[model samples]
Target chain A: MQQLDNTFTALSDVTRRAIVARLADGEQSLSKLAEPFEMSQTAVSKHVRVLSDAGLVIVEKRGRIRHCKLDAAPMKEAIDWLKYYEAFWADKFASLTKHLAKD
Target chain B: MQQLDNTFTALSDVTRRAIVARLADGEQSLSKLAEPFEMSQTAVSKHVRVLSDAGLVIVEKRGRIRHCKLDAAPMKEAIDWLKYYEAFWADKFASLTKHLAKD
Candidate 1:
């Protein structure tokens, strides 16, 4: 749990979101994952660590390579919780549009 | 927005999540929302404020009573981001099930 909390909190940063987006393409080595960004590899590693803690990503070691792959379970839980509120917003936006049309 | 970051960070707490869950039922007054939890009204208010800052909740003051309503928009954004990974998880789970069945 606390790890889960930190995971989402860590991801609240746009940099982390961008890293996750890149990882979504396929598994990549830690160094490869760090390449596109200006941040230090250590910082990217920290972000990856947070993602791993959240269970959003799985990291595996083989020979000299450490590969990171996206893990979906925690993300599913997060999305489900978020979806409840998405419905609320959809309804509110619909009502607003309807009122605007009437006006 | 730093406010958005803080809002999600604030919501990572279970107590705040529970409060959001309660508010999802319908709009409720500040004290009424605070009553179910043993925490102080001030703490609950702080949670509500975070929710408001996150655009997850709308607070309106009518006389001395402040009503809180679920806002839903920021939640939609959060869910959309989470959903991308939800799909990633679904695919991974499907593959895992297939592999397990083969085994």
Candidate 2:
């Protein structure tokens, strides 16, 4: 779906990839996610928004804190699509080896 | 690799995805690849060049024909990376279901 596209597109950014990697450890507040990077909090917020929109992250407000947790559904879909293509390449590579051997 | 990044970024475009899908069938000359699309041959050429640089396609010149064939090496890497993330999600989802059942 369009959400899947947005998720993949957002994940394509290096900054967003790091955010997802951080969230993989455990849920963290918005400030904590932004702390390690030199980027401004506003920039980190935008990256988090992209991940949340992609369903890669779940954001919830508890008291005054915005906690982010990895959702993982969209990541699974992206991975499924990638795995299919990976199998295709494995076949292609095997054939390539055979073709080269025949030469 | 930077080339891999460029290839994935280029392929993120719908036009380039169409071009790669077309090249998957068999080797085709530059003009043949451009003919079906309403886009200019120059635009198609740019897409083809991006694919060629990504190592997704092999280009060889025989007479005036520039034939492009799917290379599949970089595609293998991208798919492999995606597969790893997909497995992570599967585990996360399984855990989520268990927690939900406990509720």
Candidate 3:
């Protein structure tokens, strides 16, 4: 559950989500990952740091360059949590339908 | 995207997540929702407020009682966003399999 806390907290920002989306294709140098955004590399790096801290992204330093890669396991956990409520919603829908049928 | 931000931020706390989980069974009075936790009703109400701001939970007043209900739409949206990366992880797994095969 703490993992979910970290995962969701790290993902609450738009820029962080975009960074994750970009890294989904393949591993990228921090600079390369920062290129698509208008923000400074430092700004982007901060976002990456949040993602890394949450275990959503992995950062490896190779010489002077830092590379970022997506780690989707935490994301899978988040999805599992959200999916649990699917049954709840499905039941609500079923009940709604039944109630309407009575009318 | 802002909705996603609110949804994720609202869910980042353990107490809030527990509140959400309990509400999944059915609508619960605010006091009833706080009953299982050691926290005061005020503390639980704050958590509920955050969930309400995120549009994850709906609060209604019937007389002096507040009925809290789970709104699964935002949770569904969050799941949709996370599920987009399913393809990325699947591809990564396939590539890992191929690499292992070669070794």
Instruction: Score chain B of candidate 2 by TM-score.
Output: 0.82
DockQ each: 0.45, 0.33, 0.47
Question: Any runs in candidate 1 off by more than 4 Å, and if so which?
Answer: A1-7, A92-94, A97-103, B1-7, B92-103
Native contacts retained, all candidates in order? 0.68, 0.29, 0.68
lDDT of each: 0.75, 0.71, 0.86
RMSD of 2: 4.4
- The residue-by-residue lDDT of candidate 2 on A26-91, one tens digit each, is 679999999989989999998898788777888999999999987766756555544544543678
- Worst 10 contiguous positions by lDDT, candidate 3 chain A: A94-103
**Model 2 lDDT tens row, B14-89:** 6766776777687899999999998899999988888787767778899999998776557666655555455346
lDDT of 1 by residue, A1-103 (tens): 5654665676687777777777767778999999988989999999888888777788999999999987667766666667666666577667587347433
**TM-score for chain A in each prediction:** 0.81, 0.83, 0.84
> In TM-score terms, which candidate is top?
3
Ranking by lDDT: 3, 1, 2
* lDDT tens readout by residue for model 3, A1-103: 7889999999999999998888888899999999989999999989999999998888888999997888776787888888877755557777456435545
Docking class of 1: acceptable
Comparing chain B with the reference, what is the TM-score for each candidate? 0.79, 0.82, 0.85
lDDT by residue for model 1 over B25-87, one digit each (tens)? Answer: 989999999998888999999988887777677788999999987666666556666665665
Task: After the best TM-score superposition of candidate 1, give how far the Cα of residue B42 lies from its true spot, in angstroms.
Answer: 1.8
